[model samples]
Target: MHLKDIIWMGGLLTVLSFPVSATEIEWPVYGGDNLHQRHSKLTQITKNNVSGLVEAWEFDTGINATFQATPVVQDGVMYVSLPFNDVVALDAASGKQLWRYEHDLDEDYPICCGPANRGVAVSNGMVFTGTIDARLIALDAKTGEKRWDNRVVGDNTGIREEVSRLDDSELGSVSGTSGAGINMAPMIYQDTVIIGITGVGYGLHLDATDSDSPLGAVVGIAGKYGRRGFMAGYDMKTGKQKWQFDTIKSKNWEGDFVTKTADGVELPRDIAKERASLEKYSDAWRYGGASAWSTPVIDPYTGILHFGTGNPSPQMEGSSRPGDNLYSSSLLALDANSGDYRWHYQQVPHDSWGYDVASPPVLFEITIKGKPIPAIGQAGKTGWFYVHDRRNGKFLYKSEAFVPQKNMFELPTSEGTIIYPGVMGGANWSPVSVDARRRLVFIAAIHWPVEYKLHQQPARNGEAAIRYSSMSPLNTPEKHGLLTAIDLDNGEIVWQVKTENPLIGGVLSTASGLVFTGEGRGELMAFDADSGEKRWSGKTEAGVNAPPITYSINGKQHIAVAVGGNRLFGFKTGQKIKVWRLP
Candidate 1:
């Protein structure tokens, strides 16, 4: 792929609009654009020629952490953020480093999840990113020089360090150990950059019977540990906060305490018991853990920024804090300009199980009942693709379960209850791709079931009162990844592919009738977008746990992905970015 063929002859230093140009393609945002579609119009590498794709170039960032950043390309320059918030700019056509920005973080920063960064956002003349220290920073796009840095969280004192030390250092010891950190790519809208925090609601994870195998179990210990999660918009020029929207609503946090979901799915919630304790736990929303783990997608016409929220605080045990846990485990729509709440559709209310809406919400138009309507769709951890009216947050039809569903919404028992699509989810943090022309949404899912067991006895160390759940993965033979193609017109799954390992990364679809995704087993495969037939597969040194993106340099299309496997999930880890093109 040479840069001269499709490169629009323009000033080399010109700061162009997001799309870059008419002939040259650019992946300018986290989701390629504000719609979060993860789709490209380039078709030079079509299905017929996809098998001939060969390695174009590869860049090693030299740091080997859980790499999940999706490189953003624009005007022959590609920007990628490595784990630990290090930003690197590279030439899109060749594997050459342009500049690098090294971020310095405090040693004592609180972090609960794996050290992974999503990517970086480039706008005007600056590159923006959020860090593991809960800070937002912007750098000069040309030289990779720091422009401005601002802290996202106000105070870290809210972290529970005192209460955690008590209880014989077991029941509440997890608090203050790790809290809020920024792991997602920032979104640029107008003059504001949008970002959010994650890991605040995270609990201790227990190793399986064998550390070398896949995760055996997870446990969400109860405590007032993390702070309330939020998403905010900041002034791009000054890095000053413009507006903020808390995921947990302070006033109406309880809402109507509905026992069923908006789609009429009966949630196993004790409404009367929750209401009886409402007053005592009314202020729990202040410390509620509804982390915003995905980037926000904006509707250019309506100015609504949509994203999903994580699980509520003290995950898996809703005894102390109850009443629907408003907004957590929900699809939230907010006014992009003012950060005002618009509407929310909760996926799991008073969620005792960790069913976070971790997938990025995709925006598109769907025809329902012979009527076209603006809509947003999200592949949920609950094993379904949920569709909703983008204008009013109304429930549109949902696709059939892409993965196997067994004992869904069933409460954890003392004897250990099995839940399909467990904590790893039907769709975890992996992003989905949409093909508007084909009317199909490509989703990467996991079929791992977890054994959820509630523990009512005191800690073995005779710690404070203990009541929580031990979520262990059933490392049996049936665990695998499900790559599904769902037709939006009739909510039917057209084709599904199963993999030996769970699909934790993201997906990309194109006009070339191809779908691309990475597997936990270190393979990058391209499938026929229409028939779900495997067209080509290449092995990277590490697992490709990040999303795949396509862009054009000299009329030759190229596919790029970061091959840093996930350590938490036992996927091999490395620090490599591989780009492929037609030979």
Candidate 2:
């Protein structure tokens, strides 16, 4: 049956005073709902019996690439997106393949990162995905047939022009890198499907540091490169462009040039030089690079959608772009239908260290001063959990540092400077899960510090000389994973669990008092939600580097995660989706 028909029937039955079906415990949206909580209400697999959990079935897509997609299930049917933007449907109860749709991608499609498609969004009996080539396509949910495709961001000619203008030495294997393309999962709100691009603000990266590292430093070649990144809405039925919100603003993109963060943390900045060069680079927003990579959460009641933005262009070198670079490294709220800006909170202004707001915002109610206030919270790369008023973007409070912090906002030196919670951050692109009942938030974080160094070269002709910077991964004695639980009440850490390697994917919370997450070491485990105790663990062939999701069929709950590890982080690669249930 179609999704609209199911919703219609369910609403009708509810109005007719009939009981709702218990089998309707489905994960219909990407974060399990419009709020992006990533929490399930199923209690069939409680903490007491979770130790008996065993693999019920495993499905391999036969594509041995980095698999980061999270499966969305509805009515016992599961849908997942494979790397290179392929879509597949499966029987959630049996792991049987239903249908598959492979994308006919352009041979010359350019991407700054690996071939990873986060997942797909389903609504109105159709599934939607954004391609690496910067296009959005809709498919028949049951048959996996292409309905329509829309090029949200056009041709590579602009990207090629930007690359051609760069110096040969500055190219650094970046000629093949296109500025913008979608790596995030699409979300359907009302009748519009929303998605955004990544790699727009990415600097030229090379294997100069070490081949073992998944990603290297962003070599600074200062010039106008990378198109302005945006989050756009499309007609779900026809794949038509609806409304677009650019992360880079045109006028007044530069704020008051504050030297400190919104929370009053002092940041190091060369204010005199920046203000002196403001006019020369006033048009930098035209080529600004605040890529939107995470999925947005919508408050259905308020009709407002909230998401985060990445760093500015010519990353790690702010000489060309001055002022706060408004909107980059920010949490933005927009009107869901019209895409009009409601409010924004800039976490790091004129971010020179590549500290973008990579994690998605989670919405919930937080009580303050004996009054319940509607709030939104996001785990930041700066190692802080920021809580804000959902209605107006007001700073309510911030949690203590979830990961270690050292030499934050320090200038890159020619002699090399070490910084904790480096560019990869206290929390990377991984999403965090929240338990609203207990007012606890869970984060899978990394503690890998980075070394920042400056690079300078003479101008070739009468042109301006280039000044850039490079960030290399430091071989520190302590590089590990931190699974932290923070109580939202007083911003105190409840408990923290350290892993052998850094955590990347995300977390899932259940009503049965269990927190489920994966590690880079290929272990999928369950923890006591309140106490942060490792209750049970299971091993996969490769790293379980994607988010864990839970859904039930025939009153039986299943725990599932993707085991296609991330190659960028040097994790073992595999192509399997393993589902577990209490046996």
Candidate 3:
């Protein structure tokens, strides 16, 4: 795909906007402009003085929780999310809180993960967030005052009553024992904001688990209205549902698709196509699991959306869904408007490793084998870095060593499946940044094998949850973390650096020619963006998972991170914001 020769955006008709300059300040949105190019054009904080950069101003966001939120900076105000569902706007230069807005927590909300927000989206003059308690809130960027709060996922009221209705089975599913909610950042499209859901596909009902709730879905929401998914678009100004594009439309796809004709919602056409595609298909919705998990990168050039899919449930038991899964554990490039499939590449087809290829796919132009290929790269939880020809989903060699495994858990079909990048994922949600000038892709990964299991314990509260969970196979060299810089041209490893903790968040590479990543132990470090050599390391006072953002405020460039002790980050922990700048 190339640049948009036709630059007409139907959604943002009124807002006069400037074209995204090739090297304008990014940190524009969560994943760095729908293309998910975490790559930045800022180079002022390069290698030479990265070490010389020290703590300038520090402000703590909160405690040991899932701080997946990366701060989004625009104008001169920096917007970020705190431990609970709190939103904070701070002076870019002072690190002093300008305003703080909090989302009420659901006493019984099931958090598959923790109380961490992935990040915020800034468009117009507002910041957007899908909060922990299942609410979609908008706050004025300048004041941190609530503009509107819409329950995006679940209602917090009477959550305790809801909890009573659940048991071991139902509770497990809600806890991400199967997959509750772990979406990255929201994508801002025109006047509408886009976000995806990840609730382990099957909706776990009160009495029992149906094993088919349709957790994975990509929805178009209104930045103005605080509306939920695509079946409806909210008015950005009024916070009202404007239109709805329910991908599944009706809930009973496993059977009948009953819909309110008046609402413009109907049975999903994709379900019908899938039903027709199946050799012995009965129902598609009852068990359609190809959830659009991560945020999709937009190809402004082709009007296409790119994203990764998660594992099909009854996940450990692959025998459940059966045929070549259309999208699970796959990389998909689809038409943004119709949700029509363009081209797809399943990293692990009929996946069994629980290796859901759900990381935000980074978009960039790479020179591969002498060809300038615009590509999409993702480091799946299965432990592999996948780089594909973004134009056609074609394969490029993976940089990891190919070891012969017993194939003890699952097998591939006659079609040759590429080897080396197992799903624990050479690099997962911890995002990677590319240095376009240097021609390198920086990635952090957990090199381990996950033991597979479908069901281990007796059903509880009528739900089946993930059993015997652990991530031991890949965290090898025992307690080591790795930062790999790949030569984009040949898909070869240029530099391999290992740390003590699993790379929890991501690496931030700047025009200053440095890469910044936080340790699982809560310390943030800087490396030569091109050489992978350590420049400096200091504790953040907490385990860090949120990606760090560097911005120039009043002529001074500073780096700041949210701190907390994440059991997953594994680093020595503390809670307090840490900041460093050039003295």
- Using lDDT as the measure, which candidate wins? 1
Q: How many pairs collide in each candidate, listed in order?
A: 3, 1, 60
Estimate TM-scores for all models: 0.92, 0.92, 0.74
- Estimate the lDDT of model 3: 0.56
What is the per-residue lDDT of model 3 for residues 185-266, given as tens digits with 9 covering 90 to 100? Answer: 6666566665555554422221223222212211111011111122223445555444333222133223221221111213
Please report, in order, the local distance difference test score of every candidate based on alpha carbons.
Answer: 0.84, 0.84, 0.56
lDDT by residue for model 1 over 236-346, one digit each (tens)?
999899999989888878888887877788888888898898888777787788999988899989999999999988777787777888889999999999999899999
What's the residue-level lDDT of 384 in candidate 2? 95
Ranking by lDDT: 1, 2, 3
Which is the better candidate, 2 or 3, if ranked by TM-score? 2
Which residue window of length 10 is worst by lDDT in model 3? 217-226
lDDT, residue 56, candidate 2: 92
Of models 2 and 3, which has the larger lDDT? 2
**Candidate 3 stretches greater than 4 Å from native:** 1-26, 62-64, 153-182, 201-235, 238-287, 290-293, 367-371, 401-424, 453-479, 572-574
Which segments of candidate 1 are over 4 A away from where they belong? 1-24, 161-176, 207-216, 459-465
Residue pairs in candidate 2 whose N, alpha carbon or C atoms collide under 3 angstroms: 214-568
lDDT of 2 at 87: 90
